[model samples]
Target: MRKLLLRSFYRIYQSVFKMAMPFLPWRRPVLLEGAGSIKKLPGLLEELKIKNVLIVTDSTLMKLGLLDNLIKELGINGCKYAIYDQTVPDPTIENVEEALKLYHKHNCKAIIAFGGGSPMDCAKIVGARVSRPKMPIEKMKGVLKVIFKIPTLIAVPTTAGTGSEVTLAAVISNSVTHEKYPINDFCLIPHYAVHDPELTLKLPSHITSMTGMDAMTHAVEAYIGRSNTKETKKAALEAIALIHQNLLKAYTTPGDIQARAAMLKASYLAGVAFTRAYVGYVHAIAHTIGGFYGIPHGLANAIIMPHVLEYYGSAANGKLAELADHLGIGKGSQSTDQKANAFIQYLKEMNQKMNIQSNIEQIEEKDMPEMISRALAEANPLYPVPRVLFEEELKELYYKIKG
Candidate 1:
């Protein structure tokens, strides 16, 4: 009876979104992709007439000297910039306010995010805060809440996951309360995205595996979710294919330029698709895990992906079968359910090969109720889950992923 009610509710929700969202406007970023694409940044910056850019990154990249060439080019070309390399793993709102102060003090004309998702998410919020000085950044939470367009923003993702470069949303944490809040607006999308594989060559193997699976999760959920368009479907399919072909190679050979490029492309495509289609319960659950436990977002998503699929079961059969067909796994005799299970098995094997754990050691049984409630709050009325998760089911699901 509860499942029936949930299904009925979702049908109405799907109807409203399907009717309205196709007409919604989307932002596209100018993409620079290749081995030496970072060199093009100077010319692009000059073309945009951007001066005194704020570089939002973390200390690790600075320590590795990965930004040396780009920083040198900016200086040699006479573009003034300030570096805020203090962005932590999961960026919080309090520190983003600090970055905003730096942006204002430096009088930065543009914002350049130069690390992984953490820096990019921080930069997006900082841009929003700086753009509308009178409005509280907290008010910009939820969809289309920002009233002002941010300064020209450029993102260079060092990790192949997160797809924070092209996505029209950012996730920022409330550290004190341990709540993860999202800022969703078209204005948050970066004006330009640079996906130079050379920057990704130095990524550790575990990071490559986890982040590659993160991209895979994005593509899979986007393809399966209810918010898909024809364009999103195509991009998602392409992303899935590319990830399948290249993720293992990139994981095994971190220095392989071609494989790295393919993973980057896959991540970009997945981002574009999910930006439109949004993601499902995996992200909703993963976001809560991140907020509560400080688990890396990509790793959480990878760990939760197969379990969500298994839980969704028959309701997810059709789309999962489609993916199986795309992956060349199912023949004529295999049923859709069989194909879906095969896909789930494939994900398990993939995780094992990549050394991704099926469970998180840090998650506690005591926190299960909070996690379940928070996940439900985040997912309902937004995510088009194939199967609507009730509290009873959610508790059981969380138990499987707990240490």
Candidate 2:
């Protein structure tokens, strides 16, 4: 009886501790930036004693001449680097294999990911694959499975969203299965992350809006998530403020560097927050839709965020109210329920402002059941979500997003 009671008490203690851990300890190496900071990449590499580096990115960014600037900067610093510019949005297992080949062939001691989430994710896989050649990337799909320490990595973000820089999670799609698998390991977080706003100046308005919404979703989910701690809450609050203030400005005027910078910083902070606190149903549902329909991840979240928050409101009322006040809505609410509704309205209003549209046709009604199955399977294991979801409820949420 004594032993059984002790075990039960330990379980309870761990459960509560997960809920209450304050300012949850998070660690990432130095972040350096400015318009000219990309020029400093060479010196950072030298300081780390890295000789050869592999640059991981995509063709679009390369076509935009972004990689050329990086190459010039590296040349000025006398750095040796090779380009692996085949990263695609929602990178596939085949993409990882090819990048891994380049990683080994070039004998790269370090890796630089220079696009959005895809490049960063591909870089993470490269690091893992290079560390252990015989270990299949498929086996490293779950959290903390990449046991080997990876090569030194640096990430430079060209988009204001995704926040892949600070995140330990990487999303890779399996072409054969058409499933997006997340590799979650703290070992994958980059050694240095640079958020250069200047790099985002050329981003189109639609992409800016979608990415900024992604950042906002990160803040909202982090704040109300089951994993919310004092530290994560602080990070979430700051991210919310920055994203709220600057996303619209950035969207309306894509060339506004100052606004772009604010969104970039907000996305980075949101990444930092969610990296430790984890995300909730918004991401859970978004990832499913993204994989099944090839919908942009950020846009999917933007459309579905209001519905997900509504479901979460019952269990996460107080936190939602706090977010309302942060967004300057419903200060003198009649009750927590009222405040939560108002908060949801604010989200809807923001979506309208951003011109995000959703239709049921976008997500086939016939496929709702299967999407829920996959989403639940992917989400429940990691997210400290406020409430457990049933198949019917998830289907309802899907319909709501479609509407």
Q: Pick the candidate with the highest lDDT.
A: 1
Question: What count of clashes does model 1 give?
Answer: 0
At residue 240, candidate 1 shows an lDDT of 93
Off by over 4 Å in 2: 1-26
lDDT of 1 at 101: 85
Please give the RMSD of candidate 2 to the true structure: 3.8
Clash totals, every prediction: 0, 1
**What would the per-residue lDDT of candidate 2 be over residues 1-403, giving only the tens digit for each residue?**
7545643554464366476545334458579877757777788887888878999999999999887777987787777888888887889888888987787788889999998888999998889887767888788876778867889989999898888898888988887766776888878888898877888988888889888889888888888876666777888999999988898898888888889888888988899888878887888888888888888888888888888878765788888888888888876845888888888888788888878874435788887777898887777546777666657779888887777
Model 1: lDDT to the true structure = 0.88
Q: Which candidate wins on TM-score? A: 1
State the lDDT of candidate 1 residue by residue for 1-403, as single tens digits: 8778877887698668777876777778999988889988988999888878999999999998899999989988889999999999789988688888888899899999998889999999998888777778668777788857899999999999888899988888888878886788888999999989999999999889888998999999999988788999999999999999999999998889999998999999999998888888899889889999999999999999998899898889899999999999877789999999888888889999999999887888888888889888777767787877878888878887774
- Ten residues in sequence with the least summed lDDT for candidate 2: 6-15
Among residues 3 or more apart in sequence or in different chains, the pairs in candidate 2 whose N, CA or C atoms overlap within 3 Å are 23-231
